[model samples]
Target: MNKEVKELDLIIIGAGPAGLTAAIYASRAKLNMLLIEDAIVGGQVRSSYTIENYPGFKKVEGGTLADLMQEQAQELGAEIDEFDMVERVQFSDSEKIVETSSYIYKPKAVIISTGAVPRKLPIANEEKYAGKGVHYCAVCDGAMYEGKTVGVVGGGNSALEEALFLSRFAEKVILVRRYDYFKGEKATLDEVLNHPKIEVMYNWDLVDVNGAEFMEKAKIKNTLTGEEKEIVMDAVFGYIGTEPKTKLFKDYINLNPQGYILTDENMRTNIKGVYGAGDVREKAFRQITTAVADGTISALDAEKYIVESKRVK
Candidate 1:
């Protein structure tokens, strides 16, 4: 364990939109803050192809948008460390200690914006052919399957949205859903139903993926009739749901039933000095705009806490 003590007024875990936004706010306020991210700076946004929904910009590449945010934060005096993975966080009324794989941090406050991981299929060989043929973000890998047939699994909004995105590149998109009914909005359902290249296969659960190097075929079991069948496809995408990245905080922070961190409106967690934000926190929506809002709130709260602590000292 590295013994170098890197102390700051606040530490924001994750360099995604939320974390970076927090860094911007804290740094702009002249608060001594640090932003840490073990993964890529932009989080899931970097994997996206073209993001049109984000404010200000009509259309921008995901990677480009992340770069802009990162640059802005750093220019505002936010220190971003991309090497360490925060493994544990110990909170107290006076100070908060964050332990990562490489170093330990004792910041006045911590903002946990670790984000969430995509839920994957439990099928065999799914991990083996991850990038080869198995994909999660359609916007990230849809171009790879240009004119090729692809399989999409899910019954919710994410699945349907990705299927629509995939339809632009793939000649045929097979929608394999475990339930007969779609759980997405009516507008999306109508669009999917009217799509010519999309074949909606309802009540089907993906069981296995057959591929030597990449994906070639997939085996799915029908939930209603208990029938199984194999279909050929160049690639498969899973978007069932997301598991919040809160394993480290489970024993410490308060979480909801699905393991998402529980935070109040101010982004304050059960602990006073520790705050939750972005997708990692339980909220109604998980979008870039909302994440930015969460980060802003967390940073402001951290700044206020630090000022009060100084007064108490």
Candidate 2:
């Protein structure tokens, strides 16, 4: 089958905070931009229930914030294409090629903001109970388990922090770690451990999730003794880690060992006219604010690249 090809000034791979912000800047700059997303326009922010950290609003729902961003970007003349998954990226000397499931887009500049995917547990029935009583984002599904007992998997900063946040609503939170030691910061570790509603279980790994319709219990195994035990719980939240979604760019761009795209302060990758933003890029922290900042930087940098390339011609 023949593929439809369209030329664009700029192409953004995500519709999240970073990508939307980038689109806003690019549109204001009068650049013809295309924003593509595999799911909804809001990226991870849509999954969150409440956002208290984002500036401007005292407190707001994540879906609402995402909707506003989408509207603003659209009003600025940025074209949004949701549910379109990018299949591959081919970088040439002058133009970057983005092939999605529906069409092929050629852009003078490309901003990668694919973001990260949630990590999952490798236990039996864990996948079965997903969205039933198992969740990954505390900001997204934390409220559903309110006043109920839930289990959090992992001991890293994300796990510890989410457990602390869930404590506000949940009656009890069980924090289970595969290792005896924690990888999170000392201060966060101290706070999670000191919380009375949070229970810390060392050297325990989730082996199974048992329930009739929703999750009711979790089967855990002791790493050292090989003993198995079941913990009654209302829900399970896994925060092991995040993996970057950069498989399409692996052969075309320089990426870190963990598959995160490598970009400079200007959000430019090693290849010219190609930039990265959001959680896909290497950074100290991955948050809505940070991703938005990345989007702004990438759009400006892309504009500069476009001007310079025209000058050389």
What's the TM for model 2? Answer: 0.83
lDDT of 1 by residue, 1-313 (tens): 4567778789899888999999999999999888889888988888766676789999898899999999999999999988678877788666688887676789989999999989978888877989998889888789999999999998887788788889999999999988889888788789898999999987888998887778899988989989998899899999878999988888779999999999999999888889998999999888899999999999998899989887987
TM-score of each: 0.90, 0.83
Q: Highest TM-score among the candidates is held by which one?
A: 1
What is the C-alpha local distance difference test score of each model? Answer: 0.89, 0.89
Kindly list the per-residue Cα lDDT of model 2 for residues 1-313, writing each as its tens digit.
8799998788999888999999999999999889999888898888766676789987888899999999999999999998988888899666689998778998889999989997787777877899998889887788898799999998776788789889989999999899999988797799888999999999999888888999999999999999999989899899877889899889888999989999999898988999999999998898889999999999999988877776887
Model 1 bad stretches (over 4 Å): 185-191
Query: In model 2, what lDDT does residue 63 have?
Result: 93
